[model samples]
Target: MVTVKLLKPYYIKTDEQTVRVVLAYQYFTLLINQRVFQFIPIEEKEIRVSRENGKIENIHDRFAFQNGKTVIYMSLVELISAPNFLNHLHSIAQPYIQSEETKSVTLKEETEQIIKVLEERNLKRMIDQALDERNKVLFDQLVKLL
Candidate 1:
């Protein structure tokens, strides 16, 4: 069973709108639903949900998991549809959870490795672009983190 939990919630404001984004710390295991894992949302593919009359509704008609092969996605839906969903989610998410006392530790080292790989890909792209533009200032700033 996989356990999913929100790490923290934050807001980003673009010129057009302010949006809320939630990041789950243990996101890599979610890929069991299939498809490549991505830290960033694809353009025109973000799910928008809102609270209405004390219930959450999808603001848009897009289905978040139209072609996903993972079981947790359905488990998540079941969790949202019924009152007892937390228990169901708990069962699936238990393994992925860390002790509250040791919040800094990740339950699965592999998930951390996958996150590093994804971050490395983005960093490599930025590094390449910086080199092409001859921007040593930005390249040095990025490489230090890498």
Candidate 2:
């Protein structure tokens, strides 16, 4: 069994259109088989939640965290289903969440983000292929896109 808990005071960084919620390390943790685990920050783990509906933009995504060099995957969907998850989210993230009147995201910004994610995914795929083929030159070129 797994359990989720939001530890306060949550860490939040906000730019113009989105809030970056830092969960790895301190703000969040996982409990499995009665043992507690601390999340390792993988991929700089920038999670974006929509200001419009309070839903994670990548709600279907699963992120990998490390436990003593062993990798564990957890889903955003599973975490949100925890008891009182919304109440906890509201309580912890309320200070940063904007009012309904001002919470709208422009289509342009959303489209741009989608494009960025797609490009990054492509770069990662190419990078992996380069490594698999032992093509250091191509790998270097792809990494520079990061």
Candidate 3:
């Protein structure tokens, strides 16, 4: 399940009139750690038009991170429908899409490496917690002795 955290909502004045702009940041940290996809961190910008009177205008921008750098991997302007938006996403992610090339030693192959790193980090956290518990127990024993 993807969880979307809404940062804020505001209005932007455009050429015609004021349009509602919803700003949000979505991170699939858990899913990425689970090795679901290629796990490229993305910066997504979405603009939703008013349905009551104004016509819907689709504007989206996505930035993909690679080698500690960000690149504008995808962009769509004046997208009229949701399906179009999905199509745009597919086009942007086409390079990493499942194929023989992806199976080979490519950037897609690095996905497993990233997942392993995430798993190791999680293990470290678990070890830290165990150490903290053991320290607490030792402290309690010392207090009893006193």
Report the number of the highest-TM-score candidate: 2
Collision count for each candidate, in order? 4, 0, 0
Q: For model 1, which pairs clash?
A: 2-92, 2-93, 3-93, 33-70
Clashes in predicted model 2? 0
Q: Rank the candidates by lDDT, best first.
A: 2, 1, 3
lDDT of 1 at 122: 94
Candidate 3 differs from the real structure by a C-alpha RMSD in angstroms, to one decimal, of 21.8
The C-alpha TM-scores of every prediction are 0.26, 0.53, 0.23
In candidate 3, position 105 carries an lDDT of 61
Tens-digit per-residue lDDT, 12-119, candidate 1: 222212222332323322232334322222222222222111122333322222223422223335435444434433343333334454443443566798989999
Alpha-carbon lDDT, every model = 0.41, 0.67, 0.40
Which candidate has the highest lDDT of all? 2
